[model samples]
Target: MSVLTTKEIMDIIPHRHPFLLVDTIEELVPGVRAAGKKCVTYDEYYFRGHFPQEPVMPGVLIIEALAQVGAVCILSCEKFKGKTAYFGGINNCRFKKKVVPGDVLMLETELIKQKGPVAIARATATVDGKVAATAELTVAIG
Candidate 1:
């Protein structure tokens, strides 16, 4: 079950189709943490040109998905509602596994430090209980 549907998520974050990587928000604690999922498919836009014989989800997009989850965590707070969370930086990013089509990617982000308009989030992406990627994301609320 989803605490926030795709439609509802759009209300909190400024992401749309194709670019809207996150499908559902499973758990949310405003300004603190969030968990979301992305249902990867073979027909995804980038899969076409990325490789016809073998399609792999782009690492950057996976990182973006993690950022979107982090955005939801930050923007859902009452004070930050209707705002956009922009990436200040990404650090210590590591890709451990390739995310392929048909994989249900689970994304989680936890706010590690926050002060005023900037914050740091620890994010991770996984599939079938296996790690795919991890990063330390810095964000600025706008």
Candidate 2:
């Protein structure tokens, strides 16, 4: 699949600015897998409070970004179109690096299993080819 702009991604999943962590979809395979990007900047909303002196992107938000991309991977399916994917659970999550300003975060999620409205995916977030976070995500389509 070709690259997807924020607007195009928005068409597939329901996430908005600030809360919408994905800036673009670099690669997509509808229901199979997807890779997204988020350019972390110094002006991001959470920077002010996360650390006034030295900003660091929160780990949970990184997980959320992963989820958003995973949502795109799952929700883009023909039968799941226009539906919302909610987080059923996150497992084996780990944070290996601190994501900060000027870092372009690369996120990828691959759906490993699905049964009806439930799906499971393995997700990873990276910065400059270094792993930042990884998790197994389970979501329910509604």
Candidate 3:
């Protein structure tokens, strides 16, 4: 019914600082789609070593953020509340651009299919409304 702030999202997803990439979920329609934000910062732990001189958000983390958005979508469903949604797999994942500090990543995730306890979704991370990364993420309730 309402967008979830970072605090509310933290309560729903089991991710902590550094790994907690999604800063806020602006919109979520249970069992359908969700949109969120990840504000990149130079102070991030990974940035300290990701390339001291030239820090950049790793492509893998981008995919993970996307999947987490999907997870929020699934867990938003009443039945999966408080239940952990594990990443089953990622297919056709591609990084089209580099993500750096100060970039506000808009995570958009859409449910493509769901069967039993398995859910498949399409996700994308964008900066300045341009595609940064995309993938088909499979999640399972465990």
The candidate that achieves the highest TM-score relative to the unseen native structure: 1
Off by over 4 Å in 1: none
- Give per-residue CA lDDT, model 3, range 39-95, as digits (tens): 898888889888889999999999999988898999999999998889999999988
Mark the 10 consecutive residues where model 3 has the least summed lDDT: 1-10
By how many angstroms RMSD does model 2 differ from the true structure? 1.1
lDDT of 3 at 83: 85
Candidate 1, 109: how far from true, in Å? 0.2
Residue 109 error for model 3, in Å? Answer: 0.6
Q: Compose the digit string of candidate 2's lDDT tens values, residues 1-142.
A: 4489999988988888879999999998989999999999999999999998889999999999999999999988899999999999999999999999999999999999999999999999999999999999999999
Report, for every candidate in turn, its global Cα lDDT versus the true structure.
0.96, 0.95, 0.90
lDDT per residue as tens, model 1, 1-142? 9999999999998899989999999999999999999999998999997777889999999999999999999999999999899999999999999999999999999999999989999999999999999999999999
Note the clash tally of each candidate. Answer: 0, 0, 0
Q: What's the lDDT for residue 120 in model 1?
A: 100
Model 3 has an lDDT value of 0.90
Collision pairs in model 2: none
Ranking by TM-score: 1, 2, 3
Which residue pairs does candidate 3 place in steric collision? none
Q: Whole-model lDDT for model 2 versus the true structure?
A: 0.95
